[model samples]
Target: MLCAVVLNAAQAASAQSVVVQPAVQVRSVTTNNVSFAEAEVARSDSVLIVTPRLDVLTVNPGYRLNASLAADAVTYLGRSQADRLLPRAQADLTAQLVERWLFVDGRLSADTTAGNPFGVLEDESSTIFNRTTVYRQRISPYVERELSPRERLQLRTDHSWFQNRNAGGTDTRIDTYLLSQRASYELRPQPLGLRAEYTRDSSDYSNLPDSSVLFETARLSAMYEAAPQLVLTLTAGSDHARYSGIDQRETLRGFGLRWEPSERTSVGALVEKRFFGTGWAVNLAHRAPFLVLNADMQRRSTTYAAQVAALPAGGDVAQLLDSLLSTRITNPVERATAVQQLIAQRGLPATLASALDLFSPSAQLLNSASLSAALLGVRHTITLRGFYDRTEDLIGVNPPPLFSSNARQYGASLGMTRRLQPDATADFSLTRSRVVGFGTNAGVVTNNLSVRFGASRQLSLRTTVSAALRRQWVDSTAVTNANQTALSFGLLHRF
Candidate 1:
């Protein structure tokens, strides 16, 4: 259905430009503690991983597509029964249906993740029994209209679905639908505006009927330009929510401010009163010649599926640095290479940052704060990131074991990189995290620590080689403590 929709929309567009990239990677891993065991057990293992991947990008006046797909084949030396194949993919499409008036956005993704937050964390090449594959898709179509020079309107509808493949009877399926309408009018010279918006969101579950939820909201906002670079907003709204066969209503009032003193800095904040209590959000970003920083904080009612879908495509550090480098680098290939080199030197993931997702089928009151900063010197690079979060299940106490009831998690990571030569780089990183659960799982706590050292060299224009040594330790009240050390060598080639 998604392919058909995109093809039909593309028929009305002009000529299209497309690019395809294919790559292969091989890695050899050796570990003394294959199962992250305690008691100084010497269970050694050797593993081999082969991966083939493809990326596609297409652009036209009326449509665009971006996709990445990969398959990883893992072999456990002398343990054929433990070998496995893993698949991963992410794709997104945007099409303009009626010039600039109608448009559609679609996304699809599949990956494997831990089903339980307290489960042991292991590398992708090493399989764990508590992992599950997740599939998600979403489509949204909207209409944008300029009623007049100072008036505008937008109407949109979204449909999303999420599914889990698990043998533990936690196989869940969810369908979500949303409808929204917004209109605004502004007095140009007066620098004042009034906007009204309405939204209705509904979710259905296949195995958890009682967890279904529906929300309806209507709001009116007034904005005033306090200064040339500052804006203030006041909003009043009402919310109606239905969950667990219960209906509830709440009054909403919010105040917001946006400050953009310069092109390199931006700050925005919002504070509101809602059903559970006060909800707040803050965002700050600043970019300098050799430094990039971003921070945000928010508290809201959300589901795990929604959060998963909103993850950044290229990771936190990579995305921010990419945006900052865009103005300095013009060629696409050069910019991408620069981004990769920066990530490799800093010991950062090219994808999303690591986190312990407290997966839940029902709604949760989530409060989270995160900060990331990077400094680039002539031959040295330093990166730091920190995050804190608290989650409370909205469905009530005594929930299923797979669902998170109440939990607090906090973590931080610091990395340093140095250029050994023109084509060689080395890096070191340390990460720490702690998780504590309340309510039914009261007194359960887990602490994790990781240290790694890595070095990489560019073998040729299309090939690169790298080696890394990592040590991981885990101390938990819910499970036995563990210590593991792994050494790996990898080669990647592109075509």
Candidate 2:
């Protein structure tokens, strides 16, 4: 269905450009702790992995698309775990249905997720049994109309589905629907504007029908332009919600400010009072000729699927590096490809600050903050990433005792890469993370520290060779402490 939508949208375009890229990699991995257990009980193993990927991109006046599919075939020489196949895919598409009046956005993604937050964490090549594949799809269509020179209206509807492929009696299929409307009118020649908005959101769980939720909100706001680059707003709203067989009515009052002094810098913040007490969000971003910085904080009631969808397909590190190189790379397609090449050449991680996201049927009040920055020099690149997350389960039906309440996780990483030659580079990184659970899981804590060094060289325009060495240490109060050392070598070819 989604492919049909893209094809239909492309047919309406006057001009279109398409590109497909295919690549493959062969890797040899050696690890001393195959099961990530205490050294006394650990076993060694040799693993071989083959990965193949394909990416497709299309762009035109009426539509745009970026998609990729990949799979990992893993084989173990030593019998610590069985062989497995891991598949991953992601797609993002936006199309103009009727020029400026109608538009549609669609997304699809699939990946493996941890079954238990406290379980051993390892890469896809590692034979980890406590993992499951998750898939999510979303589509949104919206209408926009210009009522006058200073007035506009927008109406939109969004539908999404979340499925857990190996769900064990839990809610395996979830559907979410949302409807929203907004209207704004600005007084001509004056710095005043008024806006009205309304939204309705519903979520249904196939296996747990009683756990569904409906939320409705109506809001009004008045905005004043304080300066050419600054705006201040005051808002009032009401919410009617039903969850966990309970109903709620709340008044919402908020204030917000936005400052965009230049195209390279922006800052925004909002504070509101809701049924869950004080709620707020803040964002800051700045781009320079040689650096990029971004930081954000948010608190809201959301599902794990929603959080996963909001993240960049390539992760935070890729997202930051893409921004850092935006000025140097103007074309979107070229920039995206360049970002991936840099990540491979510099040994940068695809992801840096992901939390232990376990499956849950109920909603959660999540408080999260993240900061990322990249510095680019003539022959060197430096990156920093940090994140903190605290989640409290809300409206949980028959929640597991160990994960029924609050969980807190925080981590940080720093990496540096230096160019050794025109086609070779060396890099080093250090990372530390910790997680703590509350309530029935109180006193349960885990800490991880990792150090890595790697080097990569381009053998040709379409081939590369790389090697890496890593050591990791784990300290846990709920499980036995352990340490592991791993080495990897790989060859990649693109065609």
lDDT, model 1: 0.72
Give candidate 2 regions above 4 Å deviation.
Answer: 1-14, 123-130, 145-149, 165-190, 312-315, 395-405
Worst 10 residues of 1 by lDDT: 180-189
RMSD list, candidates in order: 3.2, 3.1
**Model 1, 1-495: lDDT tens per residue?**
456566755684457667777878888888877666675764778778888888777776777777879877878785733877877788888887776688888888887776556646554333343466677788888888777787777888777776765422245544443333333344332478777888776666556546666667777788888899888989899977776555889999999998999998999999988877898999998988788888889998766555655664223666667766866886554565577556644445543335555665566688988888877788888778888888877764434535554788887888788888867879787878888988755898888788888888877766778888988888988767887788989887778
Clashes of each: 0, 0
TM-scores, each model vs. reference: 0.89, 0.90
For model 1, the superposed segments whose C-alpha errors exceed 4 Å read 1-5, 8-14, 40-42, 123-130, 146-149, 166-189, 313-315, 330-347, 352-354, 396-402
What residue pairs are clashing in model 2? none
